[model samples]
Target: MTYTSRIDLSDHVRKQACALLQARLSDALDLEAQAKQAHWNVKGPHFLQLHQLFDSVHDEIEQFVDLLAERITTLGHVADGRITTTASATTLYGYPLEATGGEAHLKALAGSLGAFGKAVRVGIDQAGTIGDADTADLFTQISRETDKQLWFLEAHLQAH
Candidate 1:
């Protein structure tokens, strides 16, 4: 349900933006948990580096979670961030529970980041098409940061 708000955007636009934000929020929450899983389970020679990097990724995703949820509320919609909501709504492929090595976790996390980044890029265009420049800009900011995070994850997977 949407609440009454003073924002100039029409109810239709706000509802569309909120739905977009909610979907991304679920993905962000799932990604954050996956990062933490990697951080906790990573082993092998590069344990320290992988552990730190995963933790950093988790922290960054937490910010995205907050941003998406707040944008939903600002659009006058409830931000459904409960764990069950995320589990059911997230578009990301499930992170492997048995992934224990640094390389394994890195690949898994990178896949998730790539998927989320792609979705956020789509969200940017969708928001713009729906006539919400602010939401589009918000997705743009998220897409940029998500790309950087994916780069960091990919760097470890590269042989060079």
Candidate 2:
């Protein structure tokens, strides 16, 4: 008797899922960096609040990054963590770092969350086509979480 394990199923589906994962990892890192930026450089009225919120956002993203990384490795693929790899892999349109005020800072953070949500939605679709239900579920979960942060970040931009 012999025991063997394979990703099984269509190559198209697996390939597509892998591609999505790669992009997701990149997006995750970009968002992570954005959260860090928000934590470090935000100033003005809501500084402490915004700073704490950014840290929370960073922590959640760290969790998701681990989940996605493991899933990638489980599928016989490498999880990219190097700066160069993350820079090239991210589909994100770059989160700005020079925004000094609270409003401007929140506005900038919103863009990264928006991009991450979009990418996760794409990942969900790709996972579905590839019959990777678990991966699809994870993407969906990330999308919802990202949406929450999006709302929170945007809220800071409104006058209160």
Candidate 3:
């Protein structure tokens, strides 16, 4: 249910933007948890580097989670970020719990980051099409950061 707000957008537009934000919020929360999992479980020769990188990724995604949830509330909708909600709503592939090595965690995380980045890019366009430039800009900012984080993860997977 949408609460009354002084924001200029119509209920329809706000609802659409809130739905989009909610979906991304779920993904962000799931992604954050996956990063923490990698941080905690990573082993092998590159353990230190991989562990630090995974922690950093988790930190960044925590910010994204707050941003997405706040945006939903700003648009006058409740942001449901519970783990059960995220488990059910997230579009991201499940992180591999069996992944214990650097390469394994890296690959798993890169896949998730790639998927989240792709969805956020779509959200940028969707928000724009729905006439909410602010929401679109928020998505744009997130997409850029997600791409950078994906690059960091992919770099480790590269043989060079």
Candidate 4:
């Protein structure tokens, strides 16, 4: 698709931004699926709590997915968020299907969120490098929110 924008960014920069956003979209989609997997399969004493937390995390990730998709569209690129595309493009580690315990789910979730947050930090730098402040700020916002979610998941692992 041909994209013409008044955003002042060069074609190369816009393409870069779209690629970056699409990559994050894949990660967000994968993360949401993993959270749902954890929510459904989670068991043990803290099952209810962990199930609820996973749902909440999934919801937040859905919003992030929307943000990323919209950003890609704003750049005039087709946002390829299909499950197949996400499964192929995502950098997230596979969620352990054998993990049924709350602690196990929490550990997996925290690791995924940490990985995502790290990627967002890199995205922020990449957007900045292209002189796309709006995209950089978007990544910054995502990074902060992802870090907060990671903290929430990790808090369950922290000692008193």
Candidate 5:
């Protein structure tokens, strides 16, 4: 266990950081689920590419969830990675039950990436305000990765 009495933050600051990370982790989990859904249901000519892309996206999101959890736990707080916690904390729209073709799948994935990227950017800014530069850096890394995935997914939707 790591101890850092030197790092003194008000309860509000700590709470805010915890809340931000909790939100991020939740969003990451939601993204993972949606990506898996897309991976499983994607079809059409670009099936192979989209299927692989969604799996990559899911992996990235899962990594972010673990990183955020570790950071929150480092701050002397309990990290919640459970389904109920993620459902309550996430801001993502519900995943559709019906299977969709490549274009619809890309649209949904792109929208999700955009929303998750915005949240991560906001969280990074909030963490920086409280002097938590490391957390901000982590979110920055996450944002970049999300954007790359967004690019890859969006490219598949463009005209040939």
Candidate 6:
């Protein structure tokens, strides 16, 4: 698709916004995939609860992916969300394929969510700096939800 947006922001700003959005989109996709990997393979005494929690987190991250993709398109940029694209662009570390225990999966997810949440906060500032309040607000929303999910995941690892 051609860049034909007239959303008041300059082409430069749109290009920058698309870059910011696309980076986070890639991270979000990676996070979702990792969570699903945990969901499907986690096994332990707390397997049922962890499985359910990971599934819920996966669903929420899916929302972030959709929102980001739509925002990129709204800016008249093609959202390059292909797996190959995300795999290359994502900063999230690869989830261990051998990690099948609840504790291991929780640890992996908490770390990834923390990293992703940090990136989203930076994204909010970057978008706002480019005068894209809409994108900034969107990132704010995603950040809030990401933090919540991170809390849920980390809670499982907390020492009583």
- Candidate 5, 1-160: lDDT as tens digits: 3334445765566677877888888888888999999999998998998899889988888888888898788776788889998888789887766657988888888898899999899888899998778778989999998889899888877866
Name the better of 5 and 6 by TM-score.
6
Query: In candidate 6, what are the lDDT values of residues 44-129, reduced to their tens digit?
Result: 89888889999999999999999999999999999988999999999999999989788889999898999999999999999999
Worst 10 residues of 5 by lDDT: 1-10
| Candidate number that wins on TM-score, 2 or 5 | 5
Comparing 4 and 6 on lDDT, the stronger one: 6
Tens-digit lDDT string for candidate 1 (122-157):
999999999999999999999999999999999888
Candidate 2: give the clashing pairs: none
TM-score for each prediction?
A: 0.98, 0.89, 0.98, 0.96, 0.89, 0.96
Better of 5 and 6 by lDDT: 6
Candidates ranked by lDDT: 1, 3, 6, 4, 5, 2
Q: Which stretches of candidate 6 lie over 4 Å from their true place?
A: none
- Shift in Å, residue 18, candidate 4: 0.7
True lDDT of residue 74, candidate 2: 70
* Clash-forming residue pairs, model 4: none
> Backbone collision count in every prediction?
0, 0, 0, 0, 0, 0
Give per-residue CA lDDT, model 2, range 127-155, as digits (tens).
98779887899899988888988888887
Off by over 4 Å in 2: 1-12
Give each prediction's root-mean-square deviation over alpha carbons. Answer: 0.8, 3.3, 0.7, 1.1, 2.5, 1.0
Report the C-alpha lDDT of model 4 over 44-111, residue by residue, as the tens digit: 99888888989999999999999999999898889998989998999999999898788889999888
